[model samples]
Target: MSQRHVLQVFEQYQKARTSSCQTVAELANRPQNVETLQNAGVMSLLRPLLLDVVPTIQQTAALALGRLANFNDDLAEAVVKGDILPQLVYSLAEQNRFYKKAAAFVLRAVAKHSPHHAQAVVDCGALDTLVICLEDFDPGVKESAAWALGYIARHNAELSQAVVDAGAVPLLVLCIQEPEIALKRIAASTLSDISKHSSELAQTVVDAGSIAHLAQMILNPDEKLKRQVLSALSQIAKHSVDLAEMVVEAEIFPIVLTCLKDTDEYVKKNTATLIREIAKHTPELAQLIVNAGGIAAVIDCIGSCKGNIRLPGIMMLGYVAAHTENLAMAVIVSKGVPQLAICLADEPEHHIKAASAWALGQIGRHTPDHARAVALANVLPRLLSLYMDAESSEDLQVKAKKALKNILQKCTHLPALEPLLHDAPPNILKHVVGQFSKVLPHDSKARRLFVTSGGLKKIQEISAEPGSLLQEYINTINNCYPEEIVRYYSPGFSQTLLERVDQYQPVI
Candidate 1:
């Protein structure tokens, strides 16, 4: 049928317009037909109906516009260009519960498309209206309004601050305290969006006292709600030390540790992220995690999760070990070293391997025991390989190189150090040779292995300036061996000597 026929359907009597609007909404629900419906000017037909006299026709028209806008950014911008938001925002306050719900959904649909579209909604003065809708007695209206606010706030810092400036936080806190699970999830999620943009905005969220209430939802059996709640807490906690401590002060440490063992991966992932944010700040906070037995739980998380899901746990391990020697020891005692080693060696993604390598560096950098723990896990070779691999990303390569140097400098384990002599770059080789220099002069056993493993041969081939540290280290290692052994291992030692002997004229 022509566009005229579609319009005729809505142009009929009140009952016919209501039926037509509902029919278009249902048809627009299918992804395949949204284009066909839009090409027919379905939006233009539905725009005017948003202000229809009859309640059902008005709300249904709003619902249809929402579905059309929900399909794509183009359609959403069409809704914006078609001048639909102002009517919806205007309707949001004056309409009944159902109409308010439908209008708020339309605003949400439009705002979700882009920052431009969301800004359009904000520019139309939707935020204050949406904030007011949060107070509606009907849970559905409140839920729709909360979702719209989240979409608008999620784009950037300025828009997020605008949502905060419009006074949405306290009412959002109120929504989380409501009995509805859906309401709680969206409210928590919206709060996360608002708080994620800046420390000031996050402080606004914290000052509203959302953490204690969010923490109380931890034991709820709903995985979806738990994800949002954890996300909100993580966002708020990620902003500043005081904010993170506020989350800690709520005593979710033990609960979050237990959550690491939860069957749901999202809960586990978000749980790991929340811990990571807290563990990142200070030694005292890291100690708080250690005292709560967090390292073992995170180790288990790293072991059980595959791919990117393991990322946060890997990062948490790094951040904790980054703080202090005692904290690094806590990670070592929990057997985090081997787990990180396994990730660096086995993970298919370079980013994950980089994260693992970084964490292992943190664990190994503090002291000899920490370094030995990493070296003994057999992680040094894999780190060197990643640094040497041409396919590795620069980020991965840099992290791997850093990790190798860290572990190598403190490592006295001669067996591990011996192999690194053959391949480690000049920068890393210095540390490897430095270790051998420190240890070989004092021990005969390492000197023997140094020759038997061809480590002496590898050292002789390295081209360093006469007075360079690498040459100095090579000279030190050569001194540990007998003079005859050093002479035999020197590069082209026989060929140069034979030519010199043939050209000798000292007697003449």
Candidate 2:
């Protein structure tokens, strides 16, 4: 049969059946007529027939209207504001399980598209009613009700509050606790939607002990449920600080750490994000992360993984590095430098490499001893290689340049620079000089002289008198270089240089 002919016949059937069978066969077939009715503006023509048939043909009409809900908001609003809502609500009370299940499915679709219908669904006292249906002997009814409640909670804050008010937390918590992965998935998504809108509801879930349930699901063998649990925990962590703290307290670091190795990229990414959020509110949790060998795991994630996982894991490592110097040192001691260095070589991603560099910079910032350790690991040459390789690629070039600059600025001592000068790949050394010239401050003659005269190396020469070398270096730059040259080479470096110059001038 031709599609147009079929649609024509279905419309005719709908009109005729308006007075006869309440079956949805005509309505189900009407989905094909959606574009025709919309383009023809025949929605108003069908309105009368729709209202008349809604009661007797509630199932068919509701299903058809649910499908039509996607086409036009005007039609959806008309259906809801008309008599469709009360009929669907009454269907929820039907003794016929099939009708009840069908009505719940229709209502879920309606609520998903129309916020206006959410309160009506709620006011019909369907919150507690749906919670009961969650345990229906028919899995279809249970799934339908759970889905409808999720849509309701998503659109209506009051509906979410009402769900919580009706003690729906325990019910949803039970759903999450169930062994059935499908029900658990529905429960997780439902809780995510509800908690997203109402922090109070999120707290209620937490208070009702959803975290433990959620944390358990994080280990579920099913990858889908694990991903859902990761998402739910991320949302809940955002809403409840105490809950986030409790999650950390529950010693979930090991499980979260293990998720860093998940085959599903999103699962690992979100797990890292959740860990990052947990660390943000409770900085002390960083120690736990370190204790759980999170640093090595994160570095591995950054170096080995791609896309979403790499960026988030790098971010978490940066967070840990910034929060605690000891943890930062732990990363360095864990041989993080070589892993980060290798990532700098192969990682084409600008942000991930940049984050890795930023993490290295933070590690460098902890202490000179730590900076020297990183330098000795031959990290600078690899960073320089990345910078030179990317000099033509706009995005990576900029990040590589900035990362190299930060490394130089933070790790200024000779022990760090000597290996770059002496042992660095020749091409890499050129790149370092290129970056150094670009980043080193101009206008500071004293600073320019100090940097050029190998002040860093001289400082490491234990036999060299610090005062004498500094004075000679300052005098040489002031005499040899033009102000523009000085200004261009070491603009910001002079203050520290001049301060050292003044302190050393008298002592000499």
Candidate 3:
């Protein structure tokens, strides 16, 4: 139908009987009718009907306007520009229940689709009205009102603070505790959105006692609601050490950890991510996660999860190790080393390699035994492969080399370290030489392995060149290796032949 015909239909509905007006309201709510209503300027005609004397006509107009606003930013802007927010805001206080619900629905749709529309709603002082609607006797009105404020808070920081300033936090906390599942879910979502915008705002929500309610909400089987609550906790944890400690102090780490096995990928992913964030704060926090039996969940995620989850899972394991020796011991006991070894071996993406390799290094850093665990995983070969590759970026090579150094420091049992020196970058070869010199005297097997693998000779060859940095390593080997072995190997090669003739044969 042409725009003119749609306008005529809306006009007819305005004067029609109650049933007919409801029919028009239902029709206007159709997905196909939005363009007709918008193109025909039907929303403008419906604005006055928001205050109509007959409640049914008012419901029809507001509901139709809401339908038009859903997911359409320009139309939402048009609605706000139509000076309709105040009308909706006023109607929120109406004694007629349907009018209040419909007005909230319209406001929610408008706020949800556009940041500009959300700010417009906030500027019209809708938060206080929405806060009142939180106590509405109608559950539907309460849900939509909470949902609308959520949309507003989700837009940006200033408005999020505005929502908190207007006292939405405690109301949201109450909504989560309510029996109505839908209202609780929407309130949780609002709290989550607010927490993500800024640390101060997140603290405000937590200060209002939202964390406990949010934690309690996690026990519900509703995956969607659980996802939002976990995400909120994760975002809040990301703010600072104190907030992360707060999340753990609430004793919710176990609940968050259990979500690692959630059937939903998003929930699993967010849960894994939350573990990383929380464990990053301190040894106590890391120990809290480990004590709650979260390490097994992190291991499970790294071992089994698909997509991007595995990388963060690997990282979380490493982060835990770096925090404390006991936690590092826990990761080792959990067999995280082998899993991390597998991640490095799988030809995964560079980032995955970097995170895994860096984590292995962290695990090795905890203690000599932890280093032995990493070394026993046989990651040295993979790490060396990445480090020696000419094509790898500097950061990746650095991570690989650092992991190799850390692991090899505590374990002398490895394949030939000589191959690691071949064609290694200057810094990497220097490291290999230094490692050899450190071990050559104390470790007989490593001494035999180094000489047989030809690394010592290679160091000798490299050190003779002009301006070589390998000179210090040569000195170390000379000073530390068995004296007779060093004598037979080099035989005073830097001395003149004539001067050496007394102790060695002169060439003819």
How would you order the candidates by TM-score, starting with the best?
A: 1, 3, 2
Q: Would you estimate the TM-scores of all the predictions?
A: 0.93, 0.65, 0.78
- lDDT of each residue in 1-508, candidate 2, tens digit only: 9999999998888667663333333443466666665565443443343344345454544555566654556655655665566656655666456666666765676677667767766766677778888877766677677888888887657778877777667777777876677888888888877777656777877787888888877787888888878877877776556767777765677877788788888888878878776655645677777788787787776666765566666666666767666877787777777776666556776666776776676666666566666677676666665666634355555655555555665554443564455444433444333333332345455345445666433322322234653344344434444665545444456586778787885645
Could you give the candidate ranking by lDDT, starting with the highest?
1, 3, 2
- The predicted structure with the larger TM-score, 1 or 3, is 1
lDDT of 3 by residue, 1-508 (tens): 9999999997776567456556657766677876776787776677777777788778888887888788478788888889999988877786477888888888888888767788888888789999999888888888888889998999899888889889888888888888887887788888888999878988998898887777776667988888878888888888889998888788786767778888887788778877888888889888878888888888987777654768768888988998878888999998888888888888458878888899999898756678768777777677888987887778888899888777666654435455566655566666667666667768777667777776665666564444465677677776766776665566455464456667886569
Q: How far is candidate 2 from the true structure (C-alpha RMSD, Å)?
A: 11.1
> Model 1, poorest ten-residue lDDT window?
9-18
